[model samples]
Target: MTKEQQAQLSQQGVEALDKLLKETVENRVLPATYFGVTGPEGELYYSCAGEKVFGKPEAGQVDPETTVQLFSMTKFVTSLAALQLVEQGKIAVDDPSVIEKHLPELWAQSIITGWTDDGEPQLVPRKNPLTLRHLLTHTSGLGYAFLRPDVLERYEKKEGLKGFLEANIGVEGYVRPLLFEPGTHYAYGTGVDWAGILVMRLTGQTLDEYFHEHIFGPLGIGKEEITFLPTEQVKERLQSMAARTSATKGHIILHPGWRNVAKMTPEMIGLQSGGAGMVGTLRAYLKFLAGILKCQQPGGIISPQTFELVFSDQMPEGKQPRKDLADFLEFMGVTDKQQTEGKVTHSLGLCYLANGSDDGPLPGSARWSGVAKTHYFVDPKAGIAAICGTNIMEEVPTQFLEVYSKFQRTVYDNLVQSKL
Candidate 1:
């Protein structure tokens, strides 16, 4: 679609999207809103809960402008920041010497580690040094065990979770222990967080500062309600966010002070995390994606080359697709299996699923769902994108996957059926 049409898609897509909103709201999910932009073949979006959200633009509301916490979707932004640093020769994607310059503690604390083929744990002397590339690709062997019992115990005692977050709000504290040797496996822990710290160190800027100077600064976002703003300033924004969280009321684990927006505490490190933090409107978020989707050259928020790298498969070599697929499904509770035993069916790091050998979200669509059920899709080949956000979490939230899959399929079929 032309630029004019793309802009219009937000207006046009909303009609259908509004239908989606009602369906969600009527289910008794909390207040929800979507600020999405649809390009011909790509989209960028962010969501926030607002008073009477996405229902109608309220007076002085600027609903589309207010920023909402992106949670893990910030990984995409964090990834972009790292790639930008690489583009400027400020950081090497795979250099170990740079590791010490930025994080001296991690240089010593982490023992090279991995898992054995027998499903037993193993350790190895890291053959190669960890680099920015390793972290961004999530192949740096870092792991988070909070999801498991024995592992969480070992991780907390050895790594110290609160201590970890305190020291390495972004990178400094997180770089401590290597869960495994660099490049040997993909565990998807604080590697991206480390990347955020790397951006800070290389650019001599804080995470928020770097994002504004390099990213948000260019996008003309934050035009309405502020996102990635400090907690002290988020009362209005938090109230907005609190509105959309109806689905996960019982099950979703959120930032502690989320309930009493007025009583939130401040953190020392207000860094924008690559793994899970950043607030934005769905429209602003989609604008970000549209630039990438339509990028024909080296520079548009991120260099095109770097964009390719971020989206490429980052898992370690050689594993059954079913193993990872099951991992992804199990993470979403779509299966009765565990990650190790699951199939290698999907891509990691916010990219599209590979059709799960004809069983997943189609062949060339990349999607990510937030902890709160905010989801966005990028369809490069098909020229389609969709975003759905609700304040509540589903008991079996994965069900929405089928709902969205059908939406995409409908779009595809309707197009073809018309041609026929």
Candidate 2:
């Protein structure tokens, strides 16, 4: 397509996405939402809707400049930092001894077998050594206590341990018994946090500092735009988080958990929580995603070989972990009708779809989401990256999901499919 034709189609796509975002906010599907799309060069489209604070007209509308909690989206940055270390030959993803040397505490964790008759936890030593690959792939056997309520109850009631949020007392907060043996299955949990710790131990730099010197510095992103600790200025623009009273309520109230978390001092939130700690503006995040998309070509952030590995499936072949990875994709609802065990796999830091359908991202795409309903995807085959940012807590509502899916489809239908 000619440049003029392409620009016209892109503008049409932006209008469609803008209409969707505005409608979602008008219908109270979300208190605030922002969406952006980029290619290897730079941004293709951007839009936002709703107020920064729910039910408060004076709070102003959320825009690309609004800072919001990134939650687990922080994993993508953490994983990239760890991968950079690998490129420098400071660490190896496949080597267990490197992890053992750097983060011995994580390597020494035991697998939880079952509960004894007395309600005590039964534990067994791990047979396979922990590796960076296992941690990055979510196959390290660590998982959140909330996901396993029996374990949570045993730890909190029987053993008198604090809950996950209450236990935000540094790296120790994530230290728990393994849910399965290392390299045996996929369980999303504290593995990325451990990887962050490994990066800190080896480089002697906090995640924030390391990112500033490396990732942000190279991309020209300011410290105020994206950070583990928001400045006073960034805090002023921070978007309020909300939760639906019920799916039927169709409206949002300030999320109770957000209020508690907002009150936490840095001392209270001791660890940087590489898995879910950072906050940033949508504009800055889109730049970062665009840089990642550039990695598909020459002269990118990391070496082309390293980028290939980062996007490739790291799971072992003919293993139960691959099956577990397939189950994870299905559970996340990212798979199409053509999805099968062989077609879906876990890349270093994202879910890889070997045969993505035309309705969404193309084949050879990597995607993931945050706990607060934020979503992003990088499609190498399509040469595009996109993000949908929101501040809603709890499970994603069906209305929001439908809108998000439509936004992605509209993006491809105009920017990609039209070019074909």
Candidate 3:
């Protein structure tokens, strides 16, 4: 089809997406939402609707350029940095002892079996040495406190462990022992954050600086467009994030306290969290995704060989997020019965979920999301990328997932219709 014809057809399908977004806001599913889809042949469409902050008229409407905290989505970039190092021969993912070269403290790491009857934290020797691959696959024993209550208690009771969220991601912060042996299972944790520290040690550059000099700068994204530290002007464009809460009477209510968790203060100025700690606009992040999708060809940031590693699965055979973990997530309302019933896996840098139907994206299509309700997916075989964002503090509630799923399905339906 002609380029003009392609654009016309894509626009037609976007109209359905546009209507769905409008209706979602009208129903108060979320205070605001921004989404973009770029694809198979470079077509693009995006929209923003509803108030920027729930019940805060002074905050104004969300726009295409507004920045939101990336939260866990930062993992993709951190993995990208490590993969680039692997591509350059500076690091090897398969080496079990690789992380020790940068962070020696891990050499003596132990696994937490549980507490003793006397109330002492019980520990055991690690069976297998930790590897860079283990960290990338989340098979390395690390975990987050929000998800692991044991870790939260450990962090709180540990002496001199202030700034747990703000600035404690150094050798001192690597205090938690392994939940299990390395490479045995998957638990989302600070493996990527340590990977970020490794990147800084290997390159002698900060994570933010390395991203700009290598990935963002090469793709024409302004240095200031996406950052861990937002300047005054960029800060103005940051939408206030809210935690989803039960409705008051008949109205949807949101708690804004979660916004503080994402803030970067002076104390945290130097700490770069590979697992979380990133902020960017939907437009800028989409550009990053486009670069990831395009870099497989010549003249891109990394060579095709390296790009393949990014999208391909790195998990060991039959090893993925533990079923019990999924059960706990379902209990906490983080995932539904359908999602927990199926296996959860991860690629080098993204989450590997099920394939779309015969008419949708390819079987290997990969995606991941941030804590504050931001999500993105790239279909390599179909040459399509779509992302949706909101500043809401937690995972999309089950009811909202219905809307998000519909939006995703609509995007694919439009892609198929355009082909016809």
- On lDDT, the candidate that comes out on top is 2
Instruction: Compose the digit string of candidate 2's lDDT tens values, residues 42-142.
Output: 77888888899888979788877888888888898899999999999998989989977888788788888888988788889999878898888888888
**Order by lDDT, highest first:** 2, 3, 1
Q: Model 3, 221-287: lDDT tens per residue?
A: 7866788766666777777766655444334555654335335553555477777777788788887
What is the C-alpha local distance difference test score of candidate 2? 0.77
Return the number of clashes found in candidate 1.
41
Residue pairs in clash, model 3:
none
lDDT of each: 0.53, 0.77, 0.71
Q: Which stretches of candidate 1 lie over 4 Å from their true place?
A: 4-15, 29-37, 40-62, 112-125, 157-176, 223-226, 231-233, 239-262, 265-272, 320-322, 334-349, 354-364, 392-396, 399-420
What is the lDDT, from 0 to 100, of the residue 136 in candidate 2? 89
Across 1-420, the per-residue lDDT of candidate 1 in tens digits comes to: 454344223333445545554564455333455535356434422333334333343722335544455666777677778878778887776678877688665556555344456644444455557777666656676655543334433545654555333322544345445665676655656777777777777778867777776877776555333345445544454424332234544433333322222343445434445566555556666766666666535446776576556445555455633354356556665432222254332233354454421322335556665665566666555444556554433445554554454444434333221121
Q: In candidate 3, how many Å is residue 107 off?
A: 3.2
Clash list (residue pairs), candidate 2: none
Model 1 CA lDDT for position 119: 43
**Which 10 residues in a row give candidate 1 its minimum summed lDDT?**
411-420
Candidate 2: TM-score? 0.92
CA shift of 411, model 1, Å = 5.2
